[model samples]
Target: MSHLFWLDLQNLKRIQHLFPKPRGVARSDDRKVLSGISHVIRNGLRWRDAPAEYGPHKTLYNRFVRWSRLGVFARIFRELAQPGPDGKTIMIDSTHLKAHRTAASLSKGGLKPRAIGRTKGGLNSKLNTVCDGRGRPLTFFLSAGQMSDAKGALALLGSLPPAKILLGDKGYDADWFREALAERGIAACIPAHRGRRDPASHDPCMYRKRHRVENLFARLKDWRRIATRYDRCGELFLSAICIAATVIFWL
Candidate 1:
C-alpha cells in the first residue's frame, strides 16, 4: 500500500468487511484504490491515471460509485455527527458551486423556479450545512445557489433537537423562520435584521466557531469530483457531496 492510505484503508477495509477487489482473484490491494482515491481528492486527477497498481481502473471507479450510491458514505457522515453532552448549539451556513457547462445542458429546465436563474458563472448550486459546536456536520442540504441562504437554513435546522440553540447570520432573519425555530423550543441565536434600532445579542463566544461550516466547505472541495461540478443530474451531484462529506467525517 502507498504511504497515503496504509492505515486509513486498513480500517475502512475492516469496517466494510466485504467487496471484491479487481479480477475476482484474492486481490488484497484495496489499499491502492484508497491511495488512488486520495490522489483524486488531493491532486484532482482525471481518473484515467489512477495508478495501474490499484487494480483495474474500472474496478476501482465502480467500487467508489457503488459505495457512493449505497448511502454507505452518508452513514459514515451521520456517525461523525456527535452532539455535545448537552446536545445543543449548531451553526448553519452554505457554499456556492458553479456548475460546468455540461451540467447546464443536463437541466430539464422546468417550472422549478429556483432552477431557472443564471449568472455569468453559469448554473450555480448551494451546499448548505449544519454542524455541532465541535464542527462536525449533522445535516446538509443542496439547492440552487441562487436560492436564499435562509430559505434552506430552516430545512437544515428542522431536524435538530428542539431544545438546542442554533446560530446563523442575518440572512436567517425572518419572523416566520424565527418562530419556526422558537416553536421547536430552539433559540435562534442569529443577530437582528438589518436597520433595526436594537437587536438582542447572542454569544459571540460561540458564534465565533461558526467558521466550522466554512472549514467543512474547504475540506469538501478537496475532493476533485466535488471541487468542480461535473455531474449532470442534481441527485448525482448531491450524492457526490454526501460521499465527500462521509469521507471527511471518518477522517
Candidate 2:
C-alpha cells in the first residue's frame, strides 16, 4: 500500500474549526475521520480499503458523502486560499481527468450527470481552473470533457478576484471575452486562435506566464484520485478536488 498523507496538527486544527462538535455519544472521532479522508484522497484507496486505524471504512465514506453535500470542503478551500499580493496576475486553463469505469455505473435519478463525456481521450471530465501568479489554485469549474473552453471560461469570470491581468491560452481569446476584460480594466494576455483571420494582438512577454495555471493542474493531479475520476457523484468528485486544492494551498 502507498504511504498515505495525514493532515498535520496545524491543518487538523484548521479543519476542526469548520466541523462542529456533535451533541450526543454519536460524536465524531476527529483524527481518525480526517485520517480516513486523507487516505482515500492521497492514496486513491477504495472506501473498503481504508485502514482500520482511521475508522470503519463505511462510516468514513458516509461522513465524507454527507460533508460533501454540506459543502464543507469547499468552504475550507476558500478560507485557506486567500489570494496573495501577486494575485494581480491570474492564469486560467483546463485539463481532463479520465473517468474510471466504476464512475459510469451511476443509477438513474440519483444525481445529475457527473460531467463525464466521450472525448478523444475517452470518457473524461474537464476542470477549468484559475490560479495565482505563484501557481496556487484559486477556483475551478467542472464540465464535460467535450465542452468548449470558451464555455468553461465563462465560469472563471465571476469566481476570480480583481486582477490587473488575466493570462490564458488561445482558447480564451474570443472578442467578447477580451472586451469584457478590457472594460474591467484587466489586460487580456491570451494568444489568438489559429483560425482567426485577423488575430488580435497580445503581449508576448506576459503570455509566457500562462504556464502557471498548467503547473497548478500538474500539481493537483499528483493526487491519484484527482488524476482519475472515482467518485460516481459530481459533488463528491468536486469535494475531492477541493480537498486536494486545500492541501496544495497549505503547502
Candidate 3:
C-alpha cells in the first residue's frame, strides 16, 4: 500500500490560519485528519477504507464534507495560487474526467448540480483551468463534459489574473474570445481553426509554451480522485480538485 500523505510543517503553517476555529468540543488533530483526507482522495479509496493511522474514517469524511461545503479548500487553493510579479504569461485549457456510475445515481431528482454529462465516451466532467507562466494553476472551473470549450473559457474569463498574454489551443480560437482578451489588454496567442477562411496569425514561439498547461493537467490527474470522478456533487468534486492542486502544486 502507498504510504499516507502528510502536510509538511511549512505548508501547514501557511494554510493553518484558514481553518475555522473549533467551538465547543475540540476537533481531532488538523494535520492527521487532513492527511487522511489527502490519502483517501489521492488513492481514490472509499472514505471508510481510509487507514487508521490518520484517525477514524468518519472524522475524515465529516471534515471533508463540511469544509468542502464551507469552501475552505477553495480558499486555500486561491490563497496559494496568487500570482507573483512575474506571472505575466498565462495559458488556458480543458480536460475531461470520466465519472463513475456511483456519481450518476446522485443526479436523480435533478435537485443537485451534477457537472457530469454524457458524451460519446459516456459520463464525464470537464475541468477548465488557467495557469500562470510556470504552469501553476491560477483558477479552475468545472462544467459538463459535453459543454464547449468556449463556454468554459467564458466562465473563466472574469477570474483570469492580470497577464500580458494568454495562450490556448485551436479550441479557443473564437473572434469574441480574442476580442475579450483585447479588451483586457491581454494579447491572445490561440491558433486559428482549420476551417476558418482567414486564418489568424500567432507567434509560433509563444504558442509553443502552451504545452505548459498540458503539463499542468497531466500532473493534476496523477491523483486518482482527479483522474476519475467519483463525487456526485459538483461542489464536492471541485473541492477535491482544489485540494489536489494545493498539495501537488501550491504546497
**Which is the leading candidate under lDDT?**
3
In candidate 1, stretches whose alpha carbon ends up further than 4 angstroms from where it belongs are 1-10, 17-35, 84-87, 108-117, 161-163, 197-200
| Root-mean-square deviation (CA) per prediction | 4.1, 1.9, 1.4
lDDT of each: 0.67, 0.83, 0.92
Q: Of the pair 1 and 2, which is ahead by lDDT?
A: 2
Q: Could you tell me the C-alpha RMSD of candidate 1 in Å?
A: 4.1
- What lDDT does model 2 reach? 0.83
TM-score of each: 0.78, 0.93, 0.97
Measured with C-alpha atoms, the lDDT of residue 44 in candidate 2 is 83
lDDT of 3 by residue, 20-47 (tens): 9999999999998998899998889999
The predicted structure with the larger TM-score, 1 or 2, is: 2
- For candidate 1, the TM-score is 0.78
Clashing pairs in 2: none
> Candidate order by TM-score, highest to lowest?
3, 2, 1
lDDT of 3 at 144: 94
Q: Say which prediction, candidate 1 or candidate 3, comes out ahead on lDDT.
A: 3
Per-prediction backbone clash count = 1, 0, 0
Off by over 4 Å in 2: 107-111
